[model samples]
Target: MWFHGPDKMINVHKMDRTCMALSFLSFDRKQDRRKQSAGAAGRKRFSVDFPFEAFTRDIWIICVSNVVGAFGEGLYFWVFPLYVMSLQADYIQLAIVTSALMGFAALVPIPGGLLADRLDRKKIIILSWTPWIFAPLIYSFAQDWTQLIPGTVCWGVSMLGLPAITAYVISSVGDEKKVTSVLSFVWASYSFSYIFAPAVGTYLATIIGMRSVLQISA
Candidate 1:
């Protein structure tokens, strides 16, 4: 029925609204299904099974290698300041020594990355440790800048192996996802060792002196 003058009335059926709601729900369900299918396909394409043997063996080797490196790093970092102080070096000289060692260490990672792509990473790591065998011995005899400079440079070069060791672990594990967890564990251990190393160095320096501390570090 239509009303005259200024207004008109119309009736709408409730069934139409119900139909619209149902259609929307149906569309949503289809979208969800498509998403699920895509996710499953993606997972199938990239998911890697945990290689238990490889994981265990590689983790052990990485741990041992990192521990050895960490031991040297902690001692080197902790004792250097003391060593410089023993020489009665002024702040400027100390800064120079620190800069030389750290700057070279920072620069090494770039070339090390290139080498890592082409070289056997494990061999690189072993070769890196070889420098430690002599660096400390040389530092023990360092009475002036001449001896100190070369020893510090060698220490910096030795650190170049770090990235290679990391690359080896990642490659050996064969799963990129686990790299963070593994590295976290290694770094936690490294931090713990660093905390205690200074105390040990201080005690040793008091007893046997700075040269002995450098020898022990090496």
Candidate 2:
């Protein structure tokens, strides 16, 4: 092999270094593009995959309130007939009481829908929840089956808030496309409270008594 001139060797070395630098620069550019793409994908995933970002503050408040209300309701709803019977309600009386509850619950929602359309939904929700608190207290202090009527009526009236709550949830969603997801999420949160509260309520009733459990539920 012929030896290279020093100048030629130096030039060759410079060319090699330049090629290496160009290759490294190309690699860096590709890496930067990949990072940018990944970042954009991450941002898209955050916006699309996370549903809670669709809810407003009022939606969160409503969700929490519904959870607590559902929990309290679960504490008594399963054992309501037994409690009524304990107050000396006969079979016919029980039927009447349950029928009355159903009647009021079914009928009131008509006006409730009207009120929800006309009134402040938040105030309607608060008013409706107010009666539920008193209903449990009334049950705790009932002297007879007849005395339970007023409390059942109060409980029935609490349904007045349902439409308002539904409307509020729809309004609270920033994206209309997310309304179903938000409502389902909020409703599921409420129902989740029911899974354990009924069992706990029954245990508490056995330990302390049904009336005491009703008071605790209040």
Candidate 3:
């Protein structure tokens, strides 16, 4: 007999993709470092200037946006499957929807990065949040999976702003040396929210139901 767990399979696939992306990113970083080292070896001046005001603003914005976005994402993860199940979707349908969303998300960042280089970063952030504000209300009214597809597509497209947001943070910090520290702080906050939001969302779902949780998340 054959045994398969759908959730486990999906998780394994995601892990594989993440590892591959990480490996490529690491290689790219190494190439960048080699080029930087060659440039530095040819230079004779080393000046350290700390722009405290600019650094403060950059850190504040990155921290605030990351925390808020992580909370929204965490709440969505907790409630979306429950919402779909409420609409009479089976496990296979749920998996299909999730896979589509993830597929679009992973593919969109490249275009997003290119567009971010050419466009106003702040506008991109606002535009990303625009669909999210409306998608949940649409989800609230959805009586079937067909009605859910539009909102799902909107949600998927909104993820294009993620790369833009990341680029903006890196640009704002200015000092490449501190970029990792700044990003780590922001990511730590985001990770912390994921640790707590699920339990709270689950309790809320039990008390007020999934639709209400979706509304709150939206």
Candidate 4:
């Protein structure tokens, strides 16, 4: 009887230990599941809020190119009036030049839209951007304000790509809902260059001449 009593007690203890171990394992699994769910929720929230998925490969490439182009243009565009005055342009001549720049840019959109619809958008963008490279070079070599007319025209010509860029960006995204965010992101990226390029340009112009800066920007 004494041996049987101890054996029952030991068996009961073993059963209790087994139950406790099972409970612990179950609790651990639940904890792991909870952690995994929480992590997944965090990742999902991040993806929804950050617009990361909207930046597809083509969009990213365009954003990078926009930054570079904006920076290059900003380097001299802000100080363009001063550069004009330095070239002995009177207020009237400056106004004429500015008007010509704006007028041509405004007019190009009509044909630009047609071209964007008919031509390969990528090629349109490339062709339009080509004028900008030469525009600043023209500006750098100008002897007088009259000579800047061609440069201003070239700058205006570069606006021909604007429609193509917008159309290309819209077409590049698979998700329609992400279009606004993606476009805003791209525009914001371009604006980033203006924040710093003017300061850098001013500093460089102090070290080098404005013409040299324009040449460098070109």
Between candidates 2 and 4, the TM-score winner: 4
Tens digits of lDDT, candidate 2, 27-112:
99999999999999999877665588898888888889878988888898888999999989999999988898889899888899
lDDT of each: 0.72, 0.89, 0.74, 0.89
Displacement of residue 91 (Cα, Å) in model 4 is 0.5
| Candidate 4 lDDT score at position 28 | 100
Winning model by TM-score: 4
Tell me how far candidate 2 lies from the true structure as C-alpha RMSD in angstroms: 5.3
Model 4 residue runs over 4 Å out of place are 1-46
* Model 1 Cα lDDT, one tens digit per residue, 1-218: 54554323222345567789999999999999999999998775554332333455756766776666566656656767767766768888888888888898899778877888888887887787787567777888888755688877787777768788777767666556766566566556557677777777777778898787778877
User: Which one wins by lDDT: 1 or 3?
Assistant: 3
Give one digit per residue, the lDDT tens place, for model 4 in 37-105: 999999987766567777778778778988998898899889998998999999999998889888988
Number of the candidate with higher TM-score, 1 or 4: 4
**Model 1 segments beyond 4 Å from truth?**
1-54
Candidate 3's displacement at residue 149, Å, is 1.4
lDDT of 3 by residue, 96-175 (tens): 77777788778877787888999998788778877766666677788986677777777777877878777777777767
The RMSD of every model to the true structure, in order and in angstroms, is 7.9, 5.3, 23.7, 5.6
